[model samples]
Target: MASAPQTQSLPLFYKELIPLSRQDHAKYKMRPPETAPFLANVHAVPVTVEEFPMVQRRMPIVFSVGDDAVPLALMGLNEGVNLFVDDEGKLTDNTVYLPAYIRRYPFLLARLQPESEELSLCFDPSVDWIGEFDDGEALFTDGEPSEFTKQIMQFNEQFEQAGQRTAQFVKDLREMDLLMDGEVSIQPEGAPQPFIYRGFQMINEDKLREMRGDQLRKIVQNGMLPLIYAHLMSLSLMRDLFGEQMRSGKMPQPDAGV
Candidate 1:
């Protein structure tokens, strides 16, 4: 759910990546897409530690399964469903906090070559946001990046930094052996069986509580305890999300299984 994209493996919502350059795209302009059709069917999106406070309030915060367990904001409990966004990819609730991972779509900082130490601003060519359009923000000014382009580059750079910090946070959790397979069961009225959801990882609350005083203090000092608590608090929202799905008639039949 939170696999990092490599050169050989394209990232989610991106069909083809092309390095942004003045020579190749001097006439290109950027305009926001009318609707994000790419997000219509995506359920889980990778999130960073920096976004925990806001993200937790809006959606359940869980970790993806596997060795590279990254925090994921559960937009929907099941795959190919997003309760927050409608079929057009527009948010059903305008106030919902959109994850940075989604906001940074179509543009990212990527290494041009596998062996290169430097990263370049790259974008998905398939997106309609960037093109040689008559009406949009210019990508270049006098053969150099325009202010808009520079701002985009800056945002992607910050995202990369946040990603690194998030990686460290996950590493710390793994070192403390605090991650465990997560499960959530929801029983609706008159349902014969509860809907059981699995295939995700979450913090082991028991292990966290059992940690030595010194270790606890260390985490508190490092500002991880609050983030952990935020994640724990967000779990309750899973039911709220399930309810939304049910109300929208998006929930599958009980026998279908999640």
Candidate 2:
């Protein structure tokens, strides 16, 4: 039995979100992302368990603090700044891997009703690239999802499933008491003070190392060890991200107390 509808905060870059209904959105169309960088201000994005390996190589992966504790790929060290994005919103380094979370933007699977387990395909209507257009891909045909819409829905569904797996991964970390407070500090060559970052959680190496051999084996067998290592290794990039911020001068100084 489904619960009542729940309201979730919109993800980054989403201004206004509404369910994609055949009736309301039948005339709408979607086109490939335009030149304007929709992610320019987005410094971090959600990451799935499957994305840890690829994302770890390109971005600093960390966990959000508190009960919901989702993994995030940090693109910049501070808020309102994304080191990878240029003034035009295009990625500065095309070769770098983009997290699936960003790639799935503008479309998402959401539970419209709290009691209902069924998810609805939803979109950020404010995304300029998607709207009423005759030349672009239609969202619906004959009041049914068009092929393009179907593809988008499929991707959204996959993202949602990945999100579930990611949630479980976080839960496992919590259950194992493996998560601990994380702090990172970085200073550029000419900077007077190091940028200190906090308010995030990360895997505790000490706890992990102290785990019994059998427990460690279980995690290794489940393929979680590599993911943990990836996250720990990715923390080294905090300095690199700080360097980008210095070079671009896009963000203000890091919070003194953070």
lDDT of 2 by residue, 1-258 (tens): 223236776667777667888877779988887654788877788899899889988788999989889998998877778778776788777898888778888787778776778888787777787888877899999989999988988888888889888898899899899998898776656768866789788899999989999889989999889989999999888777777666766545654312
TM-score of every candidate relative to the true structure: 0.95, 0.91
Task: Give me the runs in candidate 1 sitting further than 4 Å from their true place.
Answer: 1-6, 253-258
- Clash number for every model? 0, 11
At residue 208, give the lDDT of candidate 2.
94
lDDT for each residue of candidate 1 in 77-189, tens digit (9 for 90 to 100): 88888988889988888888999999988898888777778888888888877899999999999999999999999999999999999999999999999999988888999
The lDDT of model 1 is 0.88
Error of 2 at 165 (Å): 0.8
Which 10 consecutive positions of candidate 1 have the poorest summed lDDT? 1-10
